[model samples]
Target: MPERIRVLHVEDNPDHALLIRRSLEREDDSLEITSAASAEEALGLLEENGFHVILSDYALGSGMSGLDFLRAVRDRGHDIPFVILTGQGNEEVASEALRMGANDYIIKRSGLLQFKRVALTIRNQRETFRARREKEEVEARYRHLVENVNAGIALARGDRFVYVNPKLCEILGYSAEELTSRPFLDFVAPASRETVAERYRKRQAGEELPSTYDVWALHKDGREICLELTASVIRDSEGISTLAVLREVTRERETERRAQRMEETLDLVFRQAGEAIFIHDLEGRIIEANPAASRLTGYTREELCSMRVQDLHVPEEREFSENKLASARLDGLFGFVGTGRCKDGTIKRCAVTTSLVRMGERTLVLSLVKEVPERMTSHEEEWVAAAVDARLKAALEKAPMVAVQAYDRQGRVTYWNRASEELYGFAREEAMGKTLYQLILEAAEAEGFLQELRRVWESCTPAPGREWLTRDREGNRRWVYSTIVPVVQGEECV
Candidate 1:
């Protein structure tokens, strides 16, 4: 079947005109044929018609013959395809029809299928001409794009160059013909040949491979150039091939290498540092302990890695350690004095500075610790205050006749001597954290004592060491002398 074609048929005999339509209709009913009995009548119809092809008889019985009609149509610029049919075979007459621009010439057959053959040939010629024009248009677009694209482009097969755009030739210092004459790897630097070869071979062998890779190519002048190559597989009528897009990355690669070296140097310095350094994960488990850390803790690297930060201090000193960590968590960095327990049960006082550090996906605490001699406390006044308080406590413990005690701003018992334990009938351990008024005073007296405690802490006034009626464990009323003082931190009691 072919495109629906409209035909103008000029035949004197109605039977011959019917025969022509039948021949084309033998394959499909796509031909619309209009008949005219004379050359003059066909000319009139042609002037008012749209037709794809024309068929005319050799002798129309009119003054004009089929060859005359064909020549007249071409001269008038109609240019429609014309075919002629004759009842007799004459070499001279067929030549005349062809010379007059008749697209075809056929001898009339009463019992033959020659008209179908003519119809098939005409359709084939029209299709071939159309296909040629479309191919030329596509090639024009491809040539324009490949010549003006910014990046270098190359087409290859079997890892051998098949074609290269002008930009690729410029990048490699070669002409398009020169680049396509050799293997693509011929321009690759010697050190990068194996990598480039392996990737291309795998791709050509139909194996899965990365779509992009970095390769170093040797320039014609012997200098190395880094190229980031993005590639794709092109499948067309020409068969399978690789298409590569190349970008220069020499400066970017140099910057990356320089930054990598700097990181390596910093890692080495951190490992060989003189102070005890540690990296602990967010869960408080030791992840990395430097050489100084092992020596400082009297533990091997393996031993330290199995412990949490809480495991390194005595229970009494853990609050101070926890406090330092809490401060570091809030501020991102902090410094504090704390005591650390060694593997042999010896204690080492250390000044600890901790900060948050992020490495890859994990967030960690990085600590730089230096040992502080036990006898070299930093603040003289603080040490003296502590010593004087300890002496007063010991003196009160030995004075059996009197019950002496100390309270924090909240009236919690911090210093409870032995005499307090005996008088209140509460063990030293039980009395340590309880409020003094809650332990031994009646409700009314306890309320009054709390009011006076608040006033003393507020005024920085001592409680005049007054005597009060307080109860003992036996529920018997007993008289005791008490005093209150505030432990101050900056402008507030702590």
Candidate 2:
């Protein structure tokens, strides 16, 4: 069953009121009618009951007229739909009632036809009133949401802002009136004006483009602010427009730029450092190594990354290195002289410095290794002097037919004779403190030379003499017979 419409009917005559009630009930059973003998009585009923529709006689026989009653109801905040009933030839009066806020008017007649029309009018008026009230409620909710939403909102039409929400005014540092009165591009930074204009034109033309992007905007105070906007085209009865939501991203972009600059600076320093630097985890596994570290260890960067820090130390020095690392972890920093075993199996005397540092949640070790000369103690000097004849050393230094050069375990020049300088086109001063690979050998040949030297160092004996096609500093290739031998002091090979 449909909900009953509550109708308050005000009439002077009882018979006429009965006739209207019977006719309306015959036409539609959904109406519930209550009669009032006078306008004053109808006012009392209105106060006591909630009625959906009001029907009143144009000429009430007492206190107030129909027009007067309509005015009173409206003044009292009752927005019920009201219909005026007037006699034939009273069209002028009905029009006047309508102007006074009457919803509709019906001609009075002595039949059921006029009352039937009244019933239909009541249903139509009720629906109209409900629709109007529902529209009002929806508009209130929309206004509240748009006003309180966190992001800035704007409606743009014909290159100007048709509407700007309060949040948008706050973001742009302008009043709502100022924002709406000016062209939207006036507030856009010069750098972004062209882009904003192009996107607007394309969107109005119905072109598919990215809906969200970042743009620089000018604030009221002349400062530039980055805003990330999400926009869409809206086409309605009022024509095409663009609705946009914006959020400020200035801080986020600044942070990203700073991070990028810091990374670039660190990379430049890492590449230019002279001493070998290594970063390893608590387990002594190498994580990162600079170019100098790779060259010093005679290993490719990728190969070193896969090895442990302890793996770079000579077998006899590994336990000592481990103890130093443990002490560095507890004390924050430690330094010692240790021997590093290169990939070619030769050992280098390095002054090792280790520091414990934290990166986020992980504690890491940063190690710096610089090559140093190996000095012999008195006992070791005595042992070495007893092993080598001073006459043979002097003879070899003065030999003109042979180019004899000796390198420390790290492949750095320890001794370069006059004949060696002529053969390699490098003076003794230029060759000293320089790696043999850097002085005369090409990168491809350095590995083979290191391998030969490794054989002599590991076995503590002379390597078999071999023929090598080497390059001079002037790019001339020369063949020479080379022999690699290790010098031992006591039990340790240098």
Candidate 3:
């Protein structure tokens, strides 16, 4: 339902007021009329109520005329349309009334007949004012949104920029006028233009794509900035236009690239490590091994893959190997000195270290085996004799000096020199195969020295400057200093 139009009629004659009321009511049944007899009465009514249209007689009882009333209404900020009614119709008076802000003028004698037309004209004027106000309001909201948004926003047609917000200007270091007059592609760095064009074409085809991608954009000052761009098509009723948003992501992209390079370098190092490294599961089976492992163990990669960790240790040391693996799993690290049997039945002394490594959902044992050459030469005969001769010469030249000997685990004389003959009254050949304990009878009785020596031999640890009392071959007891060290011959323990 339409709202009723309210009419305020101000006339000095009662007949004229009644005629105006009847004409407006006949034209629009919903018209509500309010009457005032003089200009003063009209002003009072205006101050008290709201009206959509006002009609006033040009001669409003002398002092306060229709022109005066029109000025007063406008001065008070009332926007209602004011129509003038004149008893003495004259072109001069009508023109003056119009200049003084009258919306329309009609002769009193014929005014009632044109009431509908006058009412419609006034209604149209009001609607025009309302539409202007709404347009201004919408424009204000749009400006506010564009100025305050964080992302760089732009509207473009073909290659030219139609609109660019302050954020877009700030991002490119350009004024709004400067940006709008130029081609939109001018801001895109040359290297990235083709890729950006491809994405734009996809967007035009109505395909949805991820908004964020790495691209280079040129600023007004010619500096390049990495950007992440997102855009959507904006069309009117005819369907053709576009708006774009851009965000700077230079720092993020650089960081990601650096991290990727670091990961690649680390991967290369792990694959090409120089030392033998083996990874085994808790069950003692080799899960992964570096290339160095294959060369060090004298086994093909396939053969090593099939071999259990226990197979690397001497057969008698398998139980010890299992215990070490168990300890490493429980305590994280275990260190042991052991004999490793190579693929060719040759045993090598090694210091083995084991650690548990947790990778994702699985646990692995990492082993590092370092070859101990000095402890694996015990079975070489010629090298033992040569080492004994060298030591004897050094000891005999420095008489009464500490005697150092190398012995096998069974206590056989692996090294015998001139110093031992002078100190124990036995020739080098006589002491060659005899146990030092028999040459010096007190060797076994003095402070458990023989037992300690045996332990040192088995452990392959050097025992130096140990003072003990010993009986010579002739039954003479003497105090002497002795040291024992395992001898390595040709890189093997003897």
The most accurate candidate by TM-score is 2
lDDT string, candidate 1, 1-494, tens digits: 54777778888888977876777767546777789988888999999988767878888874788878888889889767787776665767888888777777777665545767667755654455457667888998987898889878888887578878888777778888778778888899989999888887777668888888899998777889899998888878888888899888876676566447646755676677777888897556899898999889999989999998878988897776666566555455445666789999999877666666656555578777777668764694355434433433443476544566777767677777787788778887887878756688877888788888889788753455455678877787866655564443334544
The worst-scoring run of ten residues by lDDT in candidate 2 lies at 383-392
lDDT of each: 0.74, 0.82, 0.72
Per-candidate TM vs. native?
0.50, 0.67, 0.46
What does candidate 2's lDDT look like per residue over 45-136, in tens digits? Answer: 99999899999998888678888888999899998999999989999999998888889999877766677788999999999999999999
Q: How many clashing pairs does model 1 include?
A: 0
Task: Write out the backbone clash pairs for model 3.
Answer: 376-492, 376-493, 377-492, 377-493, 377-494, 378-493, 378-494
How do the residues 391-421 of candidate 3 rate in per-residue lDDT, one tens digit apiece?
3244234433334455566666767666667
Model 3 residue 138 CA deviation (Å) reads 4.6
* Per-model RMSD to reference: 25.5, 21.0, 24.7
Pitting candidate 1 against candidate 2, the one with the higher TM-score is 2
Regions of model 1 farther than 4 Å from truth:
1-22, 30-112, 119-152, 157-160, 165-186, 193-213, 218-223, 229-252, 300-303, 380-494
